[model samples]
Structure formats: C-alpha cells, structure tokens
Target: MKEELIAYIKSELIGDDTMEMNSEDDLLTSGLIDSLAIMRFIGHIEATHEIKVAPQDMVIENFINVDAIADYIQRTKNS
Candidate 1:
C-alpha cells in the first residue's frame, strides 16, 4: 500500500523524481506536495482507498510521507 501511494503521488500528483523518495521523507516540507496538491491527493486517497477522509482528519502528521499516508488509510479502513 505504501508503494502504491508513492506511485500514485509520483505519477498523478508530483510527476517527478520524488517518486524515489524514502518512506520517511517529508513530502510537504520537501516541496513534493504543495498546498493545492494536498487537496487533490486527499481526494485521490479517498477514492482509491474507498474511505472517507473527514475535514478533521486533514492533519499534516497523517500525511507527512507515503508510510504515514498508507498507515492512515489502513487505520481508517479498519475503523
């Protein structure tokens, strides 16, 4: 799932070499995900994972990196 999230972020969002980033890399601070792109990426995550990401869940800590995003999705799905 982490790999899939990374692939989606790379191919659909950033479309750059950031796809090769480590799991712990800071995507937002590293300029990989800008302000506007974050919304689109959330939509992508919701659609792909078939889970709702509520407005209250839009915290930077949950989306700091691919591993975090993947874990967020897994937890949300389990809930």
Candidate 2:
C-alpha cells in the first residue's frame, strides 16, 4: 500500500520532480506543492486508503514526506 500510494503521488501529483526526491523528500519545504496541492493529496490519500483525514491531521509532519504519509495512513488504519 505504501509503495502504491507513493507511486500515485509521484506519477500523478508530483510528476517528474521525483528526480530529486528521496523517501524523505520534504514536499512542503521544497516547494514541490503549495497548500492547495497538499489538500488535493490529502483528498487522494483519503479516497485511496479509505481513511478519513481530519483537518487537524493535515500537518507538515504528516504530509511533508512520502514515508510520513505512508506512516500516517498505516497508523490511521490500525487506529
């Protein structure tokens, strides 16, 4: 699920910018995406993962990196 999610985010929302990203790529700080783009990703994750993303959960720590987003989704699923 993590791999698939990252692939979607990379191919769709991120595109060719992946040339510079590690698993810990900071999308927000690196300016890869703005707030609107972040929201779009949040929506995508919600729909893809079948999890509800709360407004309070939309933070840099959760969404800045692919690993972080994957962790967030996994944790949410367990919770």
Global lDDT scores for all candidate models: 0.84, 0.78
| Model 1, runs deviating above 4 Å | 17-19
After TM-score superposition, the amount by which residue 6's alpha carbon in candidate 2 deviates from its true location, in angstroms, is: 2.9
lDDT of 2 by residue, 23-48 (tens): 67777787777677677878888897
Worst 10 residues of 2 by lDDT: 14-23
By summed lDDT, which 10 consecutive residues of candidate 1 come out lowest?
Answer: 13-22
Error of 1 at 30 (Å): 1.1
lDDT winner among the candidates?
1
lDDT of 1 by residue, 1-79 (tens): 8877777778878887453767888988888778899999888888888999999988988988888888899899999
TM values, all candidates? 0.89, 0.82
Candidate 2 TM-score, true structure as reference: 0.82
On the 0 to 100 scale, the lDDT of residue 8 in model 2 is: 70
